[model samples]
Target chain A: MLAKRIVPCLDIKDGKTVKGINFVNFRDAGDPVELGAQYSREGADELVYLDITASHEGRKTFTELVKKVAANISIPFTVGGGINELKDVDRLLSAGADKVSINSAALRNPKLIEDIAKNFGSQVCVVAIDANYENNDWICYLNGGRIPTEKHLFQWAAEAESLGAGEILFTSMTHDGVKDGYANEALATLAENLHIPIIASGGAGKMEHFRDTFTLGKADAALAASVFHFGEIGIRDLKHYLREEGINVRL
Target chain B: MDVAIVKYNAGNIYSVNYALKRLGIEATITADPELLNKADKVIFPGVGEAETTMNYLKEQKLDVIIKNLKQPVLGICLGMQLMCRYSEEGDVNCLGIFDTDVKRFIPQKHEDKVPHMGWNTITQVKDGLFNAELENQFVYFVHSYYVPVNEFTAATTEYIHPFSASLHKDNFYATQFHPEKSGSVGEIILNNFLKL
Candidate 1:
């Protein structure tokens, strides 16, 4: 049986991790590489590094950070942010990233997804979408949830899958930092419609939240940040709880 | 010396190269027959349509060159399938390095997914690339087609049915799983191959 993944996301800025209160009032956590290794030992199924800074200096720092993280951690890692072209994908992959996630870039040039998938295989390409409920419909957001797009969540997800996305990482902007729970309504919609694996992101406050996302939302994986980073919940304990709830997890 | 990884329209060669580097061994990716033949060891990795891959190998005359290699050779995933006599994928004939046939896994019910994509434990039947250290370790696998268990089967894993997880004959070694993506256990397997 396939194990339901538990991922710890790190927001990297200028080569260091920055944790915040509601994606603002940021504070330094720790070294990205060391934190990645710690999470791996704690039984994280995989890790995601989102480069929050796309400035010229930040780009160089992010590349080095990826190399350092890859050298330390043995588990599969996905890198996102500033991935606009095929060359960007190649650069990160060569730096030891197992997969590259594209978001705003894909919207600008949908052909980029097809090209990368054709050259490197769909298994290595992931499409990350930040969505929010507006006007009684789920709408897509870009630039780390700062910009809005007219594209509906379901339509974009289906298009991404058809364009050869191996997986879809959907983050609910409304429930992101609230930690009340996942946007089950949005996740359920995407999971029910998409053939590719759907990773539910944002609003993971408690261990039961993960269970609810997997059971109710039917997500393939649940991704969280502060919950796993700040020691509020350990990955091993989370998996133990999920397993107790009859969820299939890697022990 | 760097090992040569055959780069002829194959899948997952970069991962193989990265795995070798993790084990502190350098590797070169090449499609040139002369370059591949002269390397200390050779690896052929693939993940694609069988008939098209076989045709590419035939056109390049690499099928003969690969079979004639004197050094240790490793084939992964589709690369291993191409070494077999024939594959049901697109009804293609292969290099015939191993006396076997590759068959697609047919699910009795609709629930069974075509691609068996995840980690499964292996039961070592005979020592080959794994030695005694990896008798019952789990390796990552992602494929729809598999080679039936046979004399060349060095390790066995069960999915819908028991299938060959690893195969070896003479200097040839192959695995249906992606060792490069299998974490530390996979690194050890690559180290064993490098030492061989």
Candidate 2:
């Protein structure tokens, strides 16, 4: 009876939401706490706040913002980026993040995922794989998609699941910022191969993209950034569209 | 006025506190037995492994304290699973308050996934756990193990199959889903639990 989740990814820079064209060139979005509350009110199933530049001093500020957003919003939200140690996970979860997503750190040390899953339940830790279709196949990338790994996307996703990631956020670099559609083919492969939930990230242009991802990609959730932030799609209306398209969304 | 959340290395108890805060109620997270005993309502909220957490609770003697709590006690997710007679997780026995057994979810088909995560509707709600206006509303859930339908089952949800989504007996209530994360549907449930 689980409905497909619609998530809005807010890139946080100094506690404010920012929109990065593709993976760079940041533009001011708005206050994260305000946007998060609005998304929850507008029927966003979940939210992810990714700290873009996670410095030592600014980490505290983002943590405080997460606390504020968590208090203001009733729906669950997760915090990620620059989480390198167990203490960071503890701090974010303590500050009221429902879950913590690890990207570059997990790529560096898969055991980080293992340790987190061992300590906190696997349900709390999410492994986000930033990947791109390159050289005839999908290749995984790390460090904000700057460094490409030889690791195959499907193989690494399976490894992450074994390493205790409760969910996998698969963001396709090629599809990101293009406003075309989601990487439905790769997403479908991940969904079919993995037993855990697959959160399809990047490449969400219009309302139909979300519908296609759930139907064609078979993703458990579809995530977008600019589409939601730039007023291109209101979450309430998107859910209304999805519902009309025979998608079971909470309206 | 004194609502205490029993904390024992569990995950996401802060959201529950935050939910109560939105309702204009401030809850204290504590492991102190005396504080829990004195509170008007005690919420046993958790998101952690059962056996390891059970060991921690035993080490702190919170097992006996929780079983003996006279106030309206509500357990969430792992807290609810641990309240059962036994759990398949880590092959461990649990606090025997509900007299039901918790089983690990095994996907029946290739499409059916474990860790039945995301929003699902809870039907057949009873025992004041759910507001009447919130009948069959979708609530957020993220757990792998579930308590089967039993005499104490108050609400049920279907995923891989129909299972106990909520349980109630006497003054004790519990849920397999996270009300703190279920948006307005969850807020209503928490409000009703407080009213109870």
Candidate 3:
């Protein structure tokens, strides 16, 4: 039986770990390298590094950082946020990223998904869809939820799948930062419709949230930020909790 | 001993090389028949469509070269599928190193996802790539096509159903999962393979 995955996402800005992630016992949580290695040791199935650095010069150093992190950790890792074209993906992949998650770039040009998949294989391409519920419908947003798009989340996910996305990382803007629970309804719907793996993102604050996302949401993986980052929930403890809950998690 | 990773239109080769580097072993990534044949250990790895990769292998004469290698050869993911007798991935024939067929997993339950990507436990572990210590430890996997359980299966994992998590046939070895990315457990598997 394949164990459900637990992923910790680190948001990076200007080559530094942002979001004030403070692991009191771990001294170097602020450094991405130390943080990534720590999470891998704590039994995190995978890690996602989202580079939010806004400068062009900062982009060059970020690729180097990806390579450094990839060299340190052995588990599967995904890089997202600034990937805009095939060249960007190539740099990240060459720099040791197992997969590249494309969001706004894919929304801007759907062909980018097909192009990256064609060149690097779908296994290396991930489609991250940021969706928000508006007017009784789940609408997709672009540019980090700053810009809204008419595209529906369901339709975009399916389209991305058809365009050769190996996996879908669906992050609900509405559920994000709420820390109540995941968007189980939308997540389940996507899981029901998509053939590829659906990684549920957003609203994971507690151990039960992860359990619900796996059972009710039917998600293949549950990804979160603050819970693991702030030391509010330890991955080793969470895996133990999920195991006791009868959910098959990597322990 | 020199190890050569057969690099031919594949993926995860870099990761494999890095894993070996972690163990203080440097491996050469090459498709040249002479190098592959002469190496102490050879690894076949890829992440792509089987048909296109098979065609590329044939064009480069690697299809013949890989099949004839006498050294201990290990294949991962698509690399493992290509070494099988045939694959349903692109409805093409493979290297026939293992006596098994690769078939696409049809979801028995709605939760049975394709490309069974994540960490999973391996049971019935053999002593080849997987040692006794790693008998029931988890390994990372990402593939749509699975090699069904058969005589060559070294270990088995249940996704849609029990499938070949790792395979062994004399000097030839294969794993459906990525041992390079599987953390300490994966490192042990690779380390065991190197020891062989």
Highest TM-score against the true fold, candidate: 2
DockQ of all models, two decimals each: 0.31, 0.84, 0.71
Q: Per-residue lDDT for A98 in model 1?
A: 74
Q: For residues A120-193, what per-residue lDDT tens digits would candidate 1 score against the true structure?
A: 77777889988888889888987877789888889998999899887889988888888889988788877777
Between 2 and 3, whose lDDT is larger?
Answer: 2
Q: Cα deviation in Å at residue A117, candidate 3?
A: 2.9
Q: Show where candidate 1 strays beyond 4 Å.
A: B1-4, B7-11, B26-41, B47-61, B86-92, B99-126, B130-137, B142-164, B192-196
Q: Estimate each model's TM-score.
A: 0.85, 0.97, 0.94
Q: Write the per-residue lDDT of candidate 2 for residues A151-222, one digit (tens) a residue.
A: 889999999999989999999999999999999999999988998899999899999999999999999999
Pairs that collide in candidate 3 are B11-B46
Candidate 3 C-alpha error for residue A60, in Å: 1.3
For model 3, the docking class works out as: medium
Candidate 1 per-residue lDDT, tens place, B28-115, comes to 8988889988899999998777898999999989989998888999999999898899999989989998999999998665334446
What fnat does each of the candidate structures reach?
0.12, 0.88, 0.75
**Candidate 2: deviation at residue A4, Å?**
0.2
Best by DockQ: 2
DockQ of 1: 0.31
Which pairs in model 2 have colliding backbones?
none
